[model samples]
Target: MVEPSVPRLWRAVLPICLICFLYLCSFLLFFCATNSLIYSTVCLLRANESYCAEIDQNKSLIILEESIQKESSQWALYGTLSFAIIACFISPIYGSLSDTKNRKFPIILTICNAILTGLIITIASIYQGTQLCLILYIVANIVNGFGGGTLILISSCFGYATDSCTHKEQHVQMIAIIEASLNIGVIIGYALCTFVFELHTRIWHILLVHVLLLVLALVISLVFLKNRSLSQPSTNNLSQKIIQPIYDIHDLFVGLKQNHLLISFLILLFSLFFYDLFRMGSGSIVYLYLHYMSFDDAHYAAYFSFEQLATCLALILLVLLRRRWKVNDLYLAIMGLCLSLAAPILFAFAQRNKAMIFGAIPSSMFSIYFAVCLRAIIARLVPEKDKGKAFSFVALIQNLDVVMGTIACVEIYQASIDFFPGLVFIFAATTRIIALIFILIQGLCVSRTPELLSIMPTDEIEEPILENQSDDDNNNDDELIHA
Candidate 1:
């Protein structure tokens, strides 16, 4: 293969591809930054009154004690968990709708919701009273959660990528790229957040920036995104709309059963649940732990940015390794889990801020490993038409983990704050170990039967549709394009 001819059409599409790629990267970067920094910012602000009061008990200031700070953090986290609970019911519906309708509509709507969230949250941060801020926070969460928030937005994007890809390898590549873009975005967002906070102590200025970014993302989505006409038309009446997601769940179950990969997928789902549990649970409280260790806002932002940088590097390294070695995804996932397992241990035992920072190195790799491998595996296991539903289900599992894990970790942290604030990290470490076990089981199952490793091989995946697909399925597919 000295040279391969390029298609003229590909050249024509190249500019469009670049724009889409840029849009994805920008959207993910902003989203990741927000995710990395938002909870910590809220917790820190809420704790500030306590922190200041503790420092100067008689300064005529409004400050609670360390216990109050911890309590405030817990309640803010609870607000987040509540939003996640609400989002759980919406994710599947939006997912199915994305599969049935133009993904752009949901994508745009989600970005708009994010914009609103950023604006409201900025205003909330400005409020001196915690009660008012909390109320605003709840309102923001309600708006954003009802719009399906980040989970549905990401799933829809993935579903779009799934529809566009022609082969298993391409799907894997797309997922990796998406994950890498997100990691890079995390790095950008983390640093930008820190810079903004440092430059403007008020903090709401950073929120304004986030709002601007969300608006840009929304505009890009509206202007450049195109809907795919891959699915068949559906003939279900308006009455069926309410139960569509439930039926989609059934279809997903049926799809899993037909593939004989139900056990494997379930294992993946459980692993994801625990992995997210560890990730999100630790994420919610670690800032408070760092605060307890005397780290300031800059230090906190730097720590998160470092981890994201590590994740970005890990993804880049994986891409390079794939070219030079026959690296297995299972081994990569294990490596990630091992890092995840160790980071939490280090964090839990850390006595100083520097020690806690060291843990970010491993935790960074942990961030990139599980999602990339899991999504790649899922992309291969489900039918093209059901990709939206399958990913939606994954999102649901993740949201459940986020809500439950956050609640559990916050409670643990609050209960043990006086005696052992690090207990939450220990709990996180335990969950990672459990997640690793589940992943190992999945790896072992695939290793024993490599032929069953991928549902369709790179060469044999054919086109988007299969010959055995039903007429109803075909109609559903077509209708989604028009819906």
Candidate 2:
């Protein structure tokens, strides 16, 4: 078969890129709106207008500002927990569906859910300072969570890219490009929030824009993207269809348990878990951290956008290194983990706005390396049929991070806000250290057992045909051949 041209391949993945870009823009806009509204509500409930106005203007009411921060953080934690708890359970189901069904439906469902969330948030912001507003916020998160939220969209996009590619090299490049698109979306989203807020626009206005963009994304997914799946047809029984993905997850666990490369899989999973725990924990509270450092919305957005740009550049560099230099994924992951470990420490010690902003540079350089590389590595480890379930499992771990990381970092930040607001970053740094240890151990294991590299069939190897063999025998032979 002739290989497709580069431009043709890019065209195929453009829809995935656009969808990711739009979803992230909506996600960040929702985040900024939520935080701003939470702060406004806390001030309204806790203090008089004159005092709140003074706090907003003066920026030196240390005690009162800390109080408001703690209160707002508590509310933010609740909102995050509500969404993450639901998404944690729903992610696997959607991931399984993408594997067993098609990728487009999940992508479209997520965008529709985002649009609904934007509308709910807009209404909530209008009713700010009321209990109903708080209730609506929680309800909106629950609704978004039920649709699988950002994690599901990301998982499905990765699964879609994986399905579209025929070779491991192409797979890695596609994953890198998708990861870059995610960062680009984040950068533009934050920048847009800053720009609109600088114009003194209301939170609802920004949310309206978010909803419109999501509607566009929904249209793209529905009309432009093709339904793609590698799994066989599902059973006609409704009950079986409902439970099959869950069963697939269980079977994946069983398969992992019995695999000869179980140690490598566990190490990679743990590394991903700890790294995400650090990332999510730090990210959930980083905005608040910047707030404490006297940074405004524009400042925070610029800082975050710069960091994301650096991350995007790093991903591009990774793709080049893999394609041109033929760098091993494990080595690149180790390098990224090593370089990223210092960022949280720098953030912990940062006292000035510049210090806090620049502290992320070390991390921005290589922090995304492990995440992108590990997913590609894990993809290479499993069979094609298990890719969806495997990525779903990854998404489950990330959602778990959303719950655990938010709780841990928010609690830490709340406790230390008065004395040392940087404590949360220190905790994040510790998690990265743990991730590094896991990756190092995996590298050692791989080096000691070279045959572990051959666990999966590469694209260069054509599937063998079994002459006059039973179906059962052929299936067994296929597994053995791949193994």
Candidate 3:
């Protein structure tokens, strides 16, 4: 059979690619504004006795660090959790909109939200000492939420790309590039913060600049992007076309209510939920922990950056493996189990000596490896039409990484300092074990359901020709972007 040509990343979407690059630059510059300027303020407050007299929590560094440790740091945990609610609303809805309308509205919404987010933060900084940081934080979180909540935007596009592909292996490669872009964004953001913004040194100004970068990115993206119609509208009735996405979201709950496949993925969800919570919440501790034990903060962040870089590099290895292994549900479950093990095991050993623990502990870099794998697995499980809803369901909880990490990881650190040091590992480990057990059980049950058995590949199952469309395609959405 003649094969359909799948567009390569660098070649297919030059305009969108430029938008992504400018967006990355803007995101990293904002990081420079917010974090890099403030590193020493952190080091000083934490290591007060080393230089100045007893440091005050209200001092520049102390307050910033505490802000991160607390649930209410404005952008860290509490506020993010609240704004994430807004994201939960926007992600899937925008995704459906993109599929129906070719992603223009949501992409436009993103540009507007990003601009508003910056303007709001800049305003808040003007009133920092007054009774206004709280309000600004909330608005900023919501704005950023709206701006960053476009994961489903890309997911929908990739789903379209996947649907267009003839070879299954091509789909996996495309998804890897998307996932890799996220890691690259993180690295650039941190590097910009460390070298440029100096956020740790200056409290308010840099943060405002970070806000401006969001606006800047929006402007850049708007200038560069060119939209293509994704899906054709159905003639049955405009009403059904308009409401198809809403029905898609409803089908998700219904799917969970009716099917066991969603439940199997949920087993993996718990691990993602808790692991993110602990890791993000306790991120600052890596430097602090190392410094307290007489290590260098610059070197520490560098080490972390390197670890993440390594993980990104690891994606290349998966490209080779994906083609060999069938990208199926059972394998996804197996990979999930493997990732769940990394965290608790790392946390369990983080209590050991500094050098050894740093080598073994499950840092953000290590977690990204798991994230990319899980994402690919999830993509393979569902059909293209439902991919937006399915991925949004994952995004609902996935983006809460910082909040959950703050709660599970940070709160644990604060309480455990003198009381129960190993509790972090215990909590992390136990959570994974429970999730793993659920997955094993779910996996066995999935073996029996003929609906699932027929859809997914099994030891005894034979590979079937790729269906023209999954059930969602039968819905034949008119208003979608094109997933």
Candidate 4:
């Protein structure tokens, strides 16, 4: 490989990295904003008391199961589902297009979408006294779907950079940085939720903050983030060329079907399913239980924060220890699965011990850190050209899991309203275990492909070997045919 002129590489590639940073910033912004609103909204339905009293009162009242279902029934649940599915598909479509198209095009599109989303939310907040507010919310959600294109944009550009890298070890480090952005985003988002909600009781306040951050992120993206090159050599123009109707999705699905790395990708996908299912499902139940057992939000928040802090530290430790950890990608996944599965049991027992942090940290670490490995694995498995499609397809799987898992959690909570509310979390955790078992079976089923972490350099990632064509070939054949 020709020694890459570091300057030219930086110029061509740094903008996408800038955009990726913007995407992370916006994601952290939105996620925190979403947490603030959702937490506030849910809290509104529960113990209508000061933060301190609310915790104590809620545990004994045990009416949250009823409250949530009543709240859902009051709204058209399908409306929420509509918001998610539409938001789900838009990111990849525009992102895949951006792979060949200029950076300006997608950035402009996302900006327009974010502005529209902001305006819609602003209007909804203004008229929130009327039923029309819900109508406005639906519109805002649709607009939000449009803005979701940022995730794909972020993923595709990283794929571009990953493909262009000359060294194999660089891939792991890059993947780690990419995912570190995500993990840190989550940590920051949760903190924002606590801070933002304290300032205003209104959901509108939270939504407005989300919009402003996104708008700012978009502006940064448009002005500074840029890459002028089109398809160069690797990753072929197959994905860049669109002949099929579902060209983007088709590319990902086609790869998963034929690739030897299917087991690895599939395990990560299922683990993500557990990640959302258990994490989202268990959230309130865990908190309320802590409140019941500990008797105050101040105390419980301390406990919750401690749990997250410990888990976040664990993520840092895992990234550090990853060098010495010799386990296959499968082993790391199983370790994560075991941790996630253990969280609920620990949570269930923590009530007796009154140490929420002690129980929750292991699970949180497993779910978050294991996911990082999964993405890193995929980055190693798939060729650089198709990273966008692979990552987005994985996103699709994870999000789809979220919808179903939420449904199951909601169903369990609804059925057990009169019973122990903690049961909802327990049920969700059980569902996750089932998914985990399947993942274990799949991991055990495939043992032939070399461990990705060993085969690929951690600093530079491995690109899939393109066997037939050499650097001498003039005509580009990006597709890899195994015979």
Candidate 5:
């Protein structure tokens, strides 16, 4: 059979566009679920008696800060801590399965799980008892984290991107584009939350909207997203196929042990994990912390949207800077680290809303750059076949960081909430300094091995075949199918 040739760029364009749209929907689902869960949790904790007054006769009356009090920080801490605990283990498995099977299904599964989680939180928000709501909150976290939450969902999306792109330079650009999509989604979600909170006053309604968006995202995935067959389809029974990903954990260790570049990449990921740990830990509590600063939901949502916009702008700036300067990823990373290092310090000592808002600006602007560079680097470091495992390990690190940082920050905050509400920020800032040092070392390694930057194989082009040559055309068609 004679095969018609298609343009290389055209082959990638459709999948890339679909992935970007999926990212938008998935992140919208993410931000909405997170904002609703945290805001409702905190508000409920602060105003528990209002909902449970008939049942709780022993509870004392307290309405400081208009039902947004210091004690409400505990809900933020517990919810985040519980989420990280389950997600840390699940993310690696999800990543491995993406490698062993396909990326699209795992991503679909995550969105479905997120929808369920949003519904549970909504039910919890409308319930009457504090203990019952907390139990439901814990249940919601378990479901959300069971499929690995946002990190695994994003890693699968990224793994799908790597499957489509073959060149190193293109990988970097695509990763940056994905990071930008995440920022854009955050901004949109935050704005929507702001609008809903201002207009409606009922937090459960916001969560219902979140559930609807997840359904939309799932539909989009089912209709538009294409799954590439990277690995051979398994011949095992359905039960074994389902259980096999858990055992695929060995692949991560094998990839790291067998490949030197993968080891170096893992070291770099360690640095990012520290940064993410502090960043996620502090982020979980920042809204409640802001409440103490006299900021309302509208103010917090608006400022947060502004910060996400700043992150998107920073990526744009980085692209421009790359065009003009002889800068490396590590160099750009250092610049971002310096900005991130300053943010938590400013937050820690900020006595006024202006300082807290200003503190968010620096970290928000450059943090995405660090992530972009890290993902780009890892995408280059691992072989094409192991990209899913590599990204999964990275996701695992993110989950562990979230768990560790949450535990540490929650403990520190609980102990110091009376005397020092800002102590957790100081600890978070210290972790950033540690991450900076690791980045410096990674920068030195990349400088020493410049070849690491261009590690991805370029896409191969097929030579033209005359119509008389049927055998050559069939071989080329088979190669194209495999590619």
Candidate 6:
């Protein structure tokens, strides 16, 4: 009997890779532009006879720079919180919509939101050093959040990939590829920022680049991506349409309450939650920390690009380990947590550029595996129909984590900026330790009940057949399946 032929891995996920690449490139660029704009605005305000002007020129300049850094850090914190707060409420609805309506729509909506956000920020850059500029920044965050921000786009993309694959292995590989695309996008964005800013380009110029990339992403998404959600009957009632997503979310929680895997699921959820909180907490204050160390834009870009590249390499290693050694996802996740614990500790003590760059090395060994494996584990625990809900809840938790992490880290950084800016990194390290404990508990539970997280039986799982097979080929396939 002939074996079934699955599509090549690259072919199966190429469209998603392109879409994610374009979106993340623009996404990273937008943040870099915003940070530059904020710094420029603060500098402009300082030059306009602020409190620092009363001192000697050299001392006054030093005081003025510190003030600018603090204000910019505060604004960054506020912007992150506002966006997360809005996306938190809206992500679940979009997640349900993807499961019920279609995946393409939510993705398109997110790209449109990104485009609008770029435009608003560009306009604000024109009016820098004014109250109107600040207002426009606030408005951009609100609009971006309302459209579900990056959180929805990522969840929807993952859901689409999940729908395309038929088994656990395929799910893990596809998810890893999609995540790698995101990292590659960030690398390109940071590289571009470094090159452009080195040439002394204006802030708006970078913003324009972001808008152009977003437009390309939008076009590619429309043309190349297929709607993968299973077809359901269209509903015409307006109120029902509005409330259905909420009902889906409610149903999700109720289902979770009833599942035997509830404890395991919660353990994974909290583990993911704390890890994200650690990531966001440290990430939100990285620029401030670098600035405090007197590192410039090029330095920051280089550091970020290195970090992203390391993550990509780690993901590649994870795929190899799963394919070559048949490692359990839970064991790999535990290994990842253990390996990554050194990163924040390294960061906490880093005082020089070399020290900071060294931190990315240990992180490269396994920092990303924890999130990817945990996500795959969660995906496997639920039924196919609940994949979207599972990912959506993850998205919601991530945004909420961002809100809490950013606020807490930012406040700590602000309070300790003068005496010890590395306190925030220590805080991040603590969160990772907590996440590690929860994952250890999960591993223990799985050890006792080995079937709890086991993959479905291969014979019971049907491989998707191609549409162009001949009658004889179909008969052969059927024979192979039944044999």
Comparing 2 and 5 on lDDT, the stronger one: 2
lDDT of 4 by residue, 424-456 (tens): 657756766776776666566554455433443
Count clashing residue pairs in model 1: 13
lDDT of 2 by residue, 1-50 (tens): 33434544565689899999988987888878787778777877877767
**Candidate 5 segments whose C-alpha is farther than 4 A from its true place:** 1-71, 128-130, 237-249, 323-326, 448-483
Q: 240-358 in candidate 5: lDDT tens per residue?
A: 86666566656655665665565566678889888887777766567656655556667778888888888888987876655445356667777888877767777777755566666
lDDT for predicted candidate 5 compared with the true structure = 0.68
lDDT (0 to 1) per candidate: 0.66, 0.79, 0.51, 0.54, 0.68, 0.77
- Least accurate 10 contiguous residues by lDDT in model 4: 460-469
For 171-255, candidate 3 gives per-residue lDDT tens digits of 5556656556655655655565455323344435545555555565566546654453456754547677556767877876576
What lDDT is reached at residue 368 by model 5?
A: 76
Q: List the residue pairs that clash in candidate 6.
A: none
Residue 379, model 3, lDDT: 62
Q: In model 2, how many backbone clashes occur?
A: 0
lDDT of 6 by residue, 103-212 (tens): 78889999999999999999998897776777788889888898888778988888877776645555666778889999999999998888887887777899999999
Two-way TM-score contest, 2 vs 4, winner: 2
Full ranking by lDDT: 2, 6, 5, 1, 4, 3
Candidate numbers, best TM-score first, in rank order: 2, 6, 1, 5, 4, 3
- RMSD, every candidate, angstroms: 7.5, 5.8, 7.6, 7.1, 6.7, 4.2
The residue pairs found clashing in candidate 5 are none
lDDT at 227, model 5: 80
Our model 1 lands, by Cα RMSD against the true structure, at 7.5
> Candidate 1's error at 94, in angstroms?
1.4
Model 1 lowest lDDT segment of ten? 1-10
